[model samples]
Target: MTREVRLTPVNEQNLEPLLSVAVAEAEPDEVMPPVDAPAGWSQARRDAFREFHRSHFGGLAGPTGNLMYAIEQDGDVVGMIRLGRTDEPGTLETGMWLGKSTRGQGIGLIALRLVLAEAIAAGARRVVADTRPENLPAVNLLRRSGAVLAQDGTTVRAEIRLGVSEDVDLLDAG
Candidate 1:
């Protein structure tokens, strides 16, 4: 039961399908910033989702720009994965979300490894991820992917050193 999951670069052609999948399969809070809409996937929330992905390249809240990828499972957009730079040199930040229907599967781990490979190929020495303590699945995925976890209040920060040979090996294992 191979999932045939791959990260596709988000572009103009795929934006509509990405938005559609998100609106139908995921809640706004689970995938994007809290949009003040009148419940359900309203037009305003849909528009915001488009703009969020569109404006991210140069408008992110980081020193460096962001790279966004559509998480495609068997050619359908199920979620998104993002990599961005931090103020610290040789380091990058990561974030992702999967549709509710896709949760509890190994898709996230595969996505993490793919994104980490992208980070390594881009010469990033480390990658960091932040999630809430309640996101046990993400915490476990980060740990299994070789990230060291540190909890600050409700936020759990996972940091992975990509420069280590053993860490790279972990990526290849399973």
Candidate 2:
């Protein structure tokens, strides 16, 4: 059965669980920037993870702040999604990463729809995401989410306008 997916605002209470999911179920390269450790979750890598999330705790609103949330499946932290204001006004740029164990269960699509609701609520006219063509899963997710994709070299930018549409209506109903 598919578990209920929800976006929990990242806070001190859930940060540890988010980090636990990142280290145990995903590789360092998959979810984080490069740390001093080459393999495994070292003290430096773990610290870096905490620092990364901590840096956002204070700034979740305003023009320059980012909205961060942990992707919780059935009450367990499984991944994360973040939306930040882009250089273009009324546009928000997003990024997400899920643990390897939960990659193919349609969790990403659910989480994505949830985030889209958040984006609309935040008064964003469009949401954009960037991924590599080789990451077929992400490419497919963005396509299914109704994003108009444009490629520049190795990066594929998926732009979803949050105006009236079937997807936005579904987000409203759900």
Candidate 3:
């Protein structure tokens, strides 16, 4: 049976699960290519990553344009999604990660749909995401979601314009 998962806005009380997912997905030892590390990162990058996580979580409690949300399945937190630069009028960037046990079960696609719907509901005309070229799953999801690849460099940038007749059948494909 397909499980019903819901995405809800992140808040102070829900920060732990968000951080847990970030820590769980951290690739500390993974060698990122120069393009992936456009900012010229090093071992010190870990601290920067930590700070990013901290600020993201902290943003949930503060007034910020970044919108964070948690994915819940069967009343359990399975993943998290974020929409940055949401205060702008036209478009926003999206990010997401599922818990280890929850991956590959088609939840990611559903979660993405939910977030996309949320973005549209929030008056966003478009949604964007950047993922490493090696991240086939994410790339495929974005492709399958009808997000056009605007930039195919080290980190691919994909985007979708909302309220279009062109649609993505993520749940059916899964």
Candidate 4:
């Protein structure tokens, strides 16, 4: 049986578990990649990383356009997916990471399908995601989800058109 993984807005109580997942998902060499750094980031880059974690996972309780959702399985948080920068209205970028304990369980594919469905239902015409060139698992996952390779450079951009309803079923078929 498949459990429905819903995207719920994050708040104080859930911050710790979210941070724990983030830390657990990252290896020493993969904490934050250079691509994650914004332009002109100096020491502030590290500070910004800390601030991002604090703001997003510190449980301060504030208004944020960024919608963070926890992936729940068997009533436990196993991973997270974020749908961000939706100001464009019809297009959204997604980022996701799953806990090590939950890896290789085919949960990421299910979570991706759920997020794509939610994005389309929320009026997103296209959804995009980027991953490092060396992240083979993510690359394969995106391709398996029917995301076309748009740009393949230092970072790879994968996009799926949500304007057509068939794309949703294609992603969910597996």
CA RMSD per model (angstroms): 5.6, 5.0, 8.1, 7.5
Best by lDDT: 2
TM-score of 4: 0.70
The clash numbers for all candidates, in the given order, read 0, 0, 0, 0
Instruction: List model 4 lDDT by residue over 1-174, tens digit each.
Output: 866555554555665566566555654224333545545434545455445544554221235445567787776777777765544445778888888887778888888888888777665678889988887888888999999986566899998787655434322322
Candidate 3 residue spans exceeding 4 A from truth? 21-63, 86-89, 164-174
Residue-level lDDT of model 3, residues 1-174, one tens digit each, is: 869899877665665665555445534332121233434334355455445544555442245556667888877777677876644346778888777777788888888998888767655678889989888888898998999986566889998888833353221221
Best by TM-score: 2
* Model 2 per-residue lDDT tens digits across residues 47-68: 9998888778754453337777
- Against the hidden reference, what TM-scores do the models get? 0.87, 0.89, 0.70, 0.70
Clashing pairs in 3: none
TM-score for predicted model 1 compared with the true structure: 0.87
Candidate 3 local lDDT, residue 95 = 84
Candidate 1, residues 73-102, lDDT tens digits: the string is: 998888899998776766779999888888
Q: Which ranges in model 4 have alpha carbons more than 4 Å from their true place?
A: 1-4, 28-64, 86-89, 164-174
